[model samples]
Target: MSMLNAMRQKSAKAERSCVAPGEAGCDPVSDEANGPRRDTESTGSGLLQAVLTRENLRQAWKRVKANKGAAGVDGLDIDQTARHLVTAWPTIRDQLLLGTYRPKPVRRVTIPKPDGGERELGIPTVTDRLIQQALLQVLQPILDPTFSEHSYGFRPGRRAHDAILAAQGYIQSGRRIVVDVDLEKFFDRVNHDILIDRLRKRIDDAGIIRLIRAYLNSGILRDGVVLERYQGTPQGGPLSPLLANVLLDEVDKVLEQHGHCFARYADDCNVYVRSRKAGERVMALLRKCYGKLRLKVNEAKSAVASVTGRKFLGYSFWFAKEGVKRRVANKPMATFKQRVRQLTRRSGGRSMAEVIERLKPYLLGWKAYFGLAQTPGVWRTLDEWLRHRLRAIQLKHWKRGSTIYRELANLGATEHVAKRVAGNSHCWWRNSNGDIKRVLTIAYFDKLGVPRLS
Candidate 1:
């Protein structure tokens, strides 16, 4: 009988901790303020009134998050994983790191096409030597433990880095109008046939080709939620970044050959020409380039705006309304928050708070997306929220623990009132404290962004 009672208590406590309407009220997963289970001392209003509905929860979440920047998560895993892969190829890495090996061997030639048109070009022979060097050069830096997943690919902010070079007179601007080009799903959508064609041009060894094919094709999804699964081969594989780097390097050569001066750091590409007429020529060349590669640009999310502090790969590329601006690696939190607000606002009033509230679904889907280590940024935000709460409670005994918490979102139905209770634990908590003599009054009282407890 005692064991049965204990079991019931445990089950009830589990039920109470969720945010959905039907279950026992749980705190926000992003808030991490939910303490160990304690028996509820029910106020006259009961726990139901305390919980917020999903709609209200969404609203409040956006209001807070839009005002604050979203954080990077599981970025470390990509770093460490990349390091391990690179270090696995030591000789190539050493050669590339020391700059002792030349990966791209320049071969100048004129080739005849099926249309009987011949063109002079400098084609790079993609040798094993080049491949190894490329991998090593890209991988060695990321191997450092400090590198986070957010740092994996070359970021868009590299343009600002080049702009600095122009400002410093290292490179003359030369009346160039620069247009940035971004490809949609560069890796995931890579056609195996195209890759094979490219690979065949370099190596004739059938064994090596087979080995590479199997290695590249083995992009089997890791065990996880279906939507989050990625192919294990070159698409989502550890070596894909390096491969993509080499591919883009080839693309860069093609762009420059057609009279478009190019600057590319990873997938973020910019084409610069000597005049506005040249800029039109550059854009035309870009279309040709993408068409040849069987790739397309996502023009909707991408733009040719007079760039400001546009973030790419976790760095800030600040472009002046007219001239190029300095390349700053990290923007202040305030700057980042403003950009987040702008992006959210531009999202057709997707309503920032609601998007943040919806972040729970992503937070819960973390296991599906990257793995156990790659949780949503909201979890850390929640922890910070809890620490504040604990400080107010004057509770010094609390210590942090692993974030291996279970999903509370999928627990109940959207139609059920209990499910509604489970979905919005915040309202539940607030309503529960309605009659309490001393509960902190939270209000958006100041524009300085002080989350107030009046």
Candidate 2:
């Protein structure tokens, strides 16, 4: 049978299984063995208990509309989903509450990873997206307080900077021995059964549990082949980050219980200790905990060393004469330069202004994070390189001596000087810094809205 027909048959079987014996409606207890009730208060704290309300669904719909992506397996785009939800959300909400809603099979697409390999990303249908958002709205508040302050990944109002600051604080206080732990294929390796078992301890509603189970079991299509994914949550799915965070909360708890000072942003964990011996002991315990949790430590990436010898979350920590110092790690800084080159390259076929516009947000955000470190000299160097890149892009756009000369004259260069500069036998970089820099001053580009690091 074709994929579509197969999916339809599978969905029908699932729906049939959801109906309890001797009952006329869908059963929330169809898989009661997998779900168990817990003591949860039915007040403002019980968001999951009141999750299926129309207002909640509308809020979820709004989040879906704001997210950018293509249509999923159901082929419904954001606009189409929004229009349909306007008229059909009440019914959808009712179905979800009744535990009769079946999520569509996830549409899988392979995306290029940073290491030149491809990773599979599962895209959920618009309806599933709405459900995931609603679930997140309810679960976020309940889960947030339980997570450690060290966990900055995927949490609202927290960031890598927060993680770095915590680590820096430890180092400045004389605890310099650090163990950096990296998880191997973390999202792809989380066991669904373990995740659900842990989640059950905190959540009570059977309907929500059923929905999460269905979401996890949803089929994934990769290269026209249907695959049963019995493990990790889909990386691109809306709820994956939250679920991953939940799965690792135990690690945080275990470390805290053992009195290890650590900071974690998702899979990246750094444990601070008083000395090398203490660091080694902490690393051993961390490995033990990870092993018990069925998680693999990328031994090649994990390291137990001094704070000055390790990099965490793209920032390198070192002990300076003044105090602890943090800077953008060398590798990450190089990567940033490569990305800037890629964005500003003439071969991209974008106009100079367009390239600068595209580069602004990335540059601005990077600067904001790195600005925490004392790097005025580094910023000036980068600013110069960026200007040279912009000049090369403009030269590519001008394309000829006459166009270059005219543009130079337009930017306030004398006719003779403009002509002489345009006819020079220098390379793009040389020409840019030589005569072009005089005409298109830094202030000129500043007025034109190009971003600066200095």
Candidate 3:
């Protein structure tokens, strides 16, 4: 038989053999002629019961269509899977319901980091990705409420800014010390057995549990060759973030039980206390809890210091003349400047308009984020620096005094003024603040689609 005929035959068999509701066991495949096996009974409040619904499958298919990732170990891209999903959904859904669906091995790709190193990223097969999306839709509501308010990370309607704001509130309320904790290789360090064991307490469906276990165990790293990954969840898998948050729920509970004031954004945690003694107590408790959970702490990055002295989620809390103030940290600002310079570099061989077009998104996003903090001075300084860089780029683009003079004249500069400005100096900084500065005003740059911090 052809592949389509074979799949249709299998699906038809599965549907006919599927156990009905109120059966002893919900197992799709069972030896019992009368009903399903007792162990497979669906008695829990878990949302996996809705997995096989056509609506849920459609939703899953929509998510797959929206993704922009590459093909997985199965060598099927989103477009290819989409083309086959209409024909494939029946068998896939039947196998999922029967607890017989096996996920393909995860494809690992290494991404280059800023410091010239690489990080492993796992991509799941298109089918598995669809299943993961469906699972997320079902599980998110159940798991979202269990997450702590101070923990932000991947949760919807929460962000690093929220974490910073929460920490700032505590600091304003007289929390003196802030203990920052960094988890060492947090995603890669999760123990699969422990994660599954904990998951069993909340979820009771065997099919769902089996699916999760398969996802956890299906990771395969190939660096020009297949490599072994003995433990921990895959970092880049669709389900990894949810699993990591679920696993860390225990840590949140432990901190709450000890009455520790804390804010967590994924593996980055900041514990606030009234004094050094309280900070020490919280830090010790955290160490014990982490030890019990087999999580490693990066001691070098972790520190218990004054709230004014530490930075969390790229924002720093400090006492100013008015009150406690929140502002962007030095490191992130420096990095932002470096990125802007790199993107707007004169020698990059891109046109001035092209460079500005590329920088619009980055500039807008960075400004929107840091704008949350009260930093008008910082914004003004950055705006001046950026305008100067643009001026330098424009000068480099002009390349010749004749071109510069013509450009200045075109911008309505008087001929004499343009000649003087163009002949002033070859130095970009001097020229940017001199004649070119007048010709290319902030309004002029704005007209050319250059984003400015205000």
lDDT of 2 by residue, 60-96 (tens): 7777778867788878898776666655654554455
Which lDDT tens digits does candidate 1 get at residues 298-405?
776554432332333223333345544333233333343343343333224343244344433433332232222112353355434422332222111111111101
Better of 1 and 3 by lDDT: 3
Clashes of 2: 0
Per residue, candidate 3 scores C-alpha lDDT tens digits across 181-268 of 8888887788867887778787766556667876776648476555555567776666788888888888888888877788988778
Question: Higher-TM-score candidate among 1 and 2?
Answer: 2
Cα-based RMSD of candidate 3: 4.7
Candidate 3 stretches with Cα past 4 Å from truth are 1-17, 20-46, 110-120
Identify the candidate with maximal TM-score: 3
Clashing pairs in 2: none
User: Could you tell me the lDDT of residue 128 within candidate 2?
Assistant: 81
User: How many clashes does the backbone of model 1 have?
Assistant: 37
**Model 3 residue 109 distance off true place after TM-score fit, in angstroms:** 3.6
The number of clashing residue pairs in each candidate reads 37, 0, 0
